[model samples]
Target: MVPHQCLGSVWSRRNRPGNEHVAPTVRATIAQFNVVASCIITTCLGDPSMTAQDRAVVVGHWIRVAKACQILGNYSSLRAILEALQSVSIHCLQRTWDNVSRKSF
Candidate 1:
């Protein structure tokens, strides 16, 4: 999905009310999850004017971060990073992808 659409869906769910049955901790956890996911997508695609090489560098940085998250057993952040990288907005940047090093993948 496109980054903006994904973020909008998450935002809607996060703000939806009338779920008193759900524990406060659970609600907070879900909110945190959504926020992390949204942030990851935004950070990856927020700057439209960035050069292809700069975008590639950002992509590489995220890849390394995902690897660290995996090693540390931070599945939530890892999933968010993966989703952001795979999102249509970032995936369609052919020039950026071309500039990304093989090691990043």
Candidate 2:
């Protein structure tokens, strides 16, 4: 089965009637999504020790990973990664963003 279809099936199962409690699979999926997003944001901004250039490199790496996710039809991951990159903390890093290559934009 396609990746999205598999995820959709798992997600749909969670919303079915009489499923009073959340399924473990669904919960795990949600957690994984949140983790991916959080990790991206943290990697970009969590370390005060990282230089602007270093942060820019990390941002570029995540962007490339997001593009790969898009190509693989993993919209859930792509959305999470994009949202992280656009989060307030990461978005406000002017120096880091300036260090990012124009080609990356």
* Best-fitting candidate, scored by lDDT: 2
Tens-digit lDDT track of model 1 for 22-71: 34455565677778777867776788788989889988988999999999
lDDT of 2 at 95: 94
After superposition, the stretches of candidate 1 with alpha carbons farther than 4 Å from their true spots are: 1-17
Model 2, residue 49: what's the lDDT? Answer: 93
Q: Model 1, poorest ten-residue lDDT window?
A: 1-10
* Model 1 TM: 0.73
- Encode model 2's per-residue lDDT on 1-105: one tens digit a residue: 235534665557666787535456557667888999999998888888999999999999999999999999999899999999998989998999999988877
What is the model-wide C-alpha lDDT for candidate 1?
0.77
The whole-model lDDT of each prediction reads 0.77, 0.85
Where does candidate 2 stray beyond 4 Å?
Answer: 1-20, 23-26
Distance from true position, residue 88, model 2, in Å? 0.3
Clashes of 2: 0
